[model samples]
Target: MKCITRSLSCLILATVASVAVACSGADGADGAMGLPGADGEAGVKGDPGAAGENGDKGDPGTAAATEGTLTGTVTDAVLKDPLADVTVTVKDSGGATLGTPVKTGADGKFSVKAPVGTVVLKLTKTYYTDSADIMVGVIAGTTVSIAATMSEAATGAPTVTLAWTGDDFGYGKTATLTATASSPTGSTLTYAWANNTATKIGSVAAGTDPKTATATLPTLADATKLRTEGGVETQYVSAYKLPDRLEVLSIVPDTRGAVSVGVTVTDGRGQKATASASLNAASIQTGLRNVALGQRVYLNSGHDGTNAWTLTTKPAGSTATGRGGICSPPPRGGEYVRGGRESRRDSRGRSSAT
Candidate 1:
């Protein structure tokens, strides 16, 4: 009890002193505040905490990363099966290659940077023609998918055949030509029918467009005819028309030859093919050009001969002398003397005897 009383007395004395100091601060008169003290130094930095566990691997990146993506599958044209190992190359309109060519995987899937504007996609593979040349429009940052196709590579040169409407050909005559362009070896080709002689040989394969062309048959006429036309006064010879010179006005049995037909084909991949054939041309003639029925023994027949190959003499008009185109020239070894008389050529090569 005495000790407790002593502790209480001391606590009481401390409380009394605090109360007296508080009173003095409240009652204090106008005293100027002291200047602010200098700032103390900053505390030292603490050590860093231990690192946290690493995060899970980020989500797998997208299949393609570019301004635009072009993804597609390659397929076989005939088999209709997905094709692998096909190289897909892209080129700009100017023919400039865009980027590294992407190859189709086993799944026939491929992804690449899709070029903008008009662009071409070329697909190529072994033992196959690159028939997957596609033109595409790429939007910025857009993804496009496509299904490309391939054609089996041609094994041999292309085969072609040329046929005509008739067995013969003549000037001023129109004949239909069956210019068959074939791919016996399984090649792609286009048929161009132009200038009458040359035409494309097969249905257009992939990578080519359906081109429109004109098939015009060529007219036949010898340039020599123009020089000789003025001198001829015959009805058939004078009836020829202007520009008619090119027209085969008539089919003379003497004029006969062959017509050549050519054709051009393209593989659509910058490769070209050509073929040619010669057709034995003839005219439709039922009768002979310059022929006549004469007496079996007419030495002096009053007939203007057409041909000068034969000799017709009427005993040289009894004087054994005749002058004409055929007889005037006579024989190379002087005049012919049947009975010690001279024979001359008629207007034609033949000697007409009067």
Candidate 2:
């Protein structure tokens, strides 16, 4: 029995030893891919996350501006002192108000803001003459400085009257111009004359009286007749009217169309007055003058009879000639003439008549 038990134990030990050796051996190579398994159950959906908190508030930002500043002073022109209690009206170049009107301080200084461009300041005060339009340019981000002067109201400014001795004056002729002055204050008066209509004037000499002067009229071309219809001719001429201010009238006679004379008189207290008058300019060469209503007159054809006749038509490349009337001269060589009608051929074989 003992022998049999020993054999059984030996067998068991051998089996155990074999199992341990197999477990401690190196790993074997991987086998071929296996068939895919069935899909498993789906997972549950997750809850949404919470939104982040709002950020902190930022600091305020500054805005850029496109405005500029203007400063100026108002002064009494004659007294050379600052003017107070004067109301200033600011206007754009087009005469539109810019802002609320500003007034001058006791020191005569003023300051205000305006859009970038030209601005005009008009000042008004009691007992003072209205100031002329003061213009100044304003720039962005900069200041413009100005000093203005205002004239005082005149109690009795010198009054002057101007007149031409004769309205009918021929072109390039001399005429007498007279000016009368009267000062309520008995202030002495001085005269300054100007030919406002003509581009250039002739010799101006003082006449016997201080207010009288003689001026050689400027020569002008004959008045142009635009058209003559039904015995009424339309002529181009110049004419001008007087103005409150002594505006210097300077323009071409042919363009503006009339002759006018101006005179300015000043008194002892530096007060000035002005007067203007129109002078009728007649055409001497054409024998043309202004006349009353329904006046009988002959029309000048502007032909001197010598070089004024023209041939309306003629045969090309042909020469012709003829004796002209008392004014038309004889035709040149290489010309054809027939019954006082003449045709002259030029170097280019063209013919023209006059």
Candidate that would win on lDDT: 2
Clashes of each: 23, 13
Candidate 2 local lDDT, 177-213, one digit each (tens): 7888898756688888776754333346667787987
> Per the 3 Å backbone cut-off, how many clashing residue pairs does candidate 2 have?
13
In model 2, the Cα lDDT at residue 223 comes to 30
Residue ranges of candidate 1 with Cα displaced over 4 Å:
1-124, 128-159, 182-188, 194-255, 280-354
Q: How close is candidate 2 to the true structure, as a TM-score?
A: 0.32
TM-scores, all candidates, are 0.28, 0.32
lDDT of 1 by residue, 150-194 (tens): 776664335455555543333233444454555544456776543
Q: Which TM-score value belongs to model 1?
A: 0.28
Global Cα RMSD, each model: 18.1, 28.5
- lDDT score, residue 224, model 2? 30
